[model samples]
Target: MDSIKVMMDIYKEDRSMKFNIFVILILSLCASLFAGTADDPNLIGWWNFNDGGAKDWSQYGHHGVLRNGARVVYDTERGMVLHNPKAGYLDPNEGHSGHVYCGGERASIADPCTWADIPRSYTVLMWIKSQMWWTPPWPGSPNQFEKEWQAIFTKGTRGYGQLIITTVGTQGRIYFRARGLQPSTNDHINGNTFIDDGNWHHIAAVCEYDAVTGQTALHLYIDGYEEYNSPVIATGSLILCSDPVYIAGSYGGSTKDGEIYMDDVRLYNRALTESEILTAMDEPIPSDFTGDSKIDMDDFRVLAKDWMETDYTIASDTGGMVAHWDFAGAAGETTVPDLVGDNDAVIVGGGQLDGNGAAVLTGGPDGPYIDLGANLGNVISDLEYCTIFIDCVWDGNSTSWQRLFTVAQPGTTEFSTITYVSVNERWLRYYQRHNAHDEETNASNPTYVPEMKGQHQIAISITKDYGLYGCTIIYIDGVKAAFHTNLAPCSLDLLGQTSRNYIGRGPFERDPLDANTINIDNRFAGKINDVRIYGRRLSERDVKDIYEGVSRQLYFKLEAPGNLSDAESTNSKVVDFKDLAALVNKWLQQVPLLEDNLN
Candidate 1:
């Protein structure tokens, strides 16, 4: 009986031990999943304000104490942002009222010595939005202009070691100060870029301290680009004080009257590389189907099946896409094949396919241009309803009026054309003439200018109602830039006219009196990519999608196994089990490196 009891006790002990081991294993796995990696070992403090309180999510335990109504609020555009509403204007008598204070007993989980290291380098990153420009006044300082400095973050006492960051205005300027023992030799750096435009902007300040000489090098980055660099000079030893760090409002007892919103405040013990900063600013690609933060295997598979194809198809979404000149062909191929209709464009003059696979059009009479033969009746018949999308890069050669796309009958004063007028190289003009009424009318949008040396996506939509006046809307890079109503009732008709449509050159000559001559003076000097024309008006959302590079088609032309052309097709082949397997292999392992930058 004693031996049997002993065996039973051993069995029970073994089971309990196994259970304990299993629980430990599960806990370790969970910790590893939730803990951040050592990729940013210098990251000592991080406050995302996502917990609806002053808790530090960095696991650094540097909790904050919110004072004077400073609280975390939900922002539609941004997840959770710190909102510091002003109590009142700077009344020297009232003292500083609102701010988030962190440090002391809640000192960062990281070693405080590293932060105080004289020669240590560090980077501070945060996203801030503020409209008012008012800084807390320094105690006993009578200068009211000093109140214009709005503090974003600060540490240390007034006469001791101090570090301060503040914004001057909405013009993208920032001012930073790092003072050591000697206040007279304090380091001051100013940023040139503007960020106070009522929008959320990523701001980073990097400081490299030379311990040997006590010299500091400072650099300011706005939206990932370095906007200012201070000259290296002596600024005394950077001593870390026992005072806590204050955010949104200054440590000094003065209140800022305006409100400010801040999010994702981080402090790194080392300077972050430019590439890392860029990675931080980049927003995750919006996933449509899976709702994942990245383009995982599932999303990639869906994108592959409809690869390279646009969402709007010729036969479906976009009504009657008469012409679609993709300008994609062999390296030197001059002819641009029309993807939808039969309006293929024949490249004229000295034209060649550029490295970017665009039709490079030079300026002048001999410059390259596309000839869309006289049969554009399907596109311009009604003239009242039509949408044209063009992707091009301007060369900044504003010597003469440049014709982007135009349609007109040869030797006739009655025609419609889109041109970049010479008076304001940035303005885009649409002119139409009705032969029946012998009237010529024009509409221009001054703000629709393309960046001189950058790529631009332009969409023009024209619509008309029977009794109401005709309307023309111009969208640049997906955003509507201008909307104009026709001065007179819509009477323009290009139906049966023997019209000549051209891209990069005007059908009418420079001499307005002689309509028969070709106007080489207004030739476009730039690269032209996918140019599509629809006989019906397109919605603003449709234009925005196209601008953002959301396509539906996967394959331009079917190729046999191993003979696939990477340029023509977005996906190598149809998505199947192999693609699924690849995705499964990656699984949750493909997280973005900059996820720490966001809340």
Candidate 2:
């Protein structure tokens, strides 16, 4: 009886062990099916180095040749790594100390490892670690790459058609170079992040040719965050050269005599999305907890519930804003919603929306104007000070009086107006009729007038004192253009008047014959992008910050004075008479008038 009992216990233990093994295998299969996959369709080449040889893991069979003492080694942090130790080639003239050639000797586009194989939109990704810091001996102390650069990877020849990535300076600043189409179209970009602090980092470079803009955009991302992006014109096909793709060093007659480790190099035929890049930064998770393949809300909620069962609120950055009008509403909508306050605007007359989503006016007698209701017009009565800001662009044809903003009392001519007086100049005209008293004041700056032909930012600040009249300061594009003190006393009583407040138009005047007759002759032409009203006077820095926050674009036309190429021969850094003459010539060649009003 004792032997039978012992045999039953042994049988039960073996059965339990087998059941556990089966459960583990099922979970592994589930994880593989649901988690992020490394076999992306756009993947052109992948080298994990786990095979302990210079072999390609992808089915394309683009194997590499490890030369000049480069070897693979096992790493605890990063599995298999290509280790390139210092080979003592300190001179710049000496060739690369050690490197791995992705393509065999005398490789070209016809064979492999060239621009012809890569698509117009492509991405390069890898994990790298620098074991030592070595500054190259170049013209610029730490930045320029005349000869020596610790090359991470490179393709194509030196000048014509090439893409090279290298580390410069002791801080391990990343540098990139590429040339496509014209030789002058060669582009160079650099990163500010330092990765040489003896730590591992994931780096990705995405290059795409934009068909709409006819330009190429290159973006660099480190640790799943975009670090830099720039657009350059690429007019033709990239050059295909017979240079082998070099890893860890370059064959450009310079030696990267520093130890570096690289692992899990990947090349893609298309630019990977930001989420995909983030997934490549880590091992696949067991399940798609977020459902988006990203650690978003769903995953965060699970993590929070497991760690800490507490609720939290995230504060927004838009505090202390009284009234903000972004004007991002739909086209032809009569009502423009205010972002912050209850003061919405009603579009009147022939106001229409533009392609850029700004309200447009045709410089006509009955142009489009926005009317702020009576309730919001009276809100200013509760404050002792106020600031008004507007971003506007004038139509060059508007030489007559144009009112940008106005506050007035209905059934009477009592009002205050901020007007644009002339084409070559701008001034503020203030008038008020209260308690049977008529007062008027104006301010202007002769030396500096608001640029009427381009986009401009206008700001006005007013402060009212109990015993003295208020002070008014007007700013144009963050610069003080006009100021007046002790001119006229502001009345809280006038603000309370149940009159219509208007933007892009002056006071409402009625004809005696018809009470509903409205004169919109003072309506402003062009477009108004953003408007804001603060309950208190803002500092100069605050005004400047608001102006800088608005998006702006500038274009420069380059012309040849004596000879287009010879204009830059005087000094590489300074703009001399030749540059000015070239600019003048370019300006003369084009029509001497503004195009499309304000852009």
> Residue 231 deviation, candidate 2, in Å?
5.7
TM-score of 2: 0.39
Tens digits of per-residue lDDT for model 2, 213-320: 666666777766655233344545554456667777776644443468888788877867788787787753222222232222243344334234222211222323
lDDT of 1 by residue, 1-599 (tens): 35334323534676664344334433443345335522355666777675566666564566787777788885534545688876554435536656787754225435454332323577788888764343221111111112356678777534343566876532235776666534444466665444543456688777777667766777777766554234335465565554567787765556332367888788777777778777666643122223222332344545465444344222332334667888878878877777877777888888877756698988764477888767765456654456789999877554567877877776666666677766565566666665444222233444444443558888877655312455566777876666665656543343335367888887665665665544545688888988988665555545666788754221222321221123322344443445344443332232231122111
lDDT of 1 at 135: 29
User: Which candidate tops lDDT?
Assistant: 1
RMSD of each: 15.8, 23.6
lDDT of 2: 0.58
Give the clash count for model 1.
14
**Candidate 1, poorest ten consecutive residues by summed lDDT:** 136-145
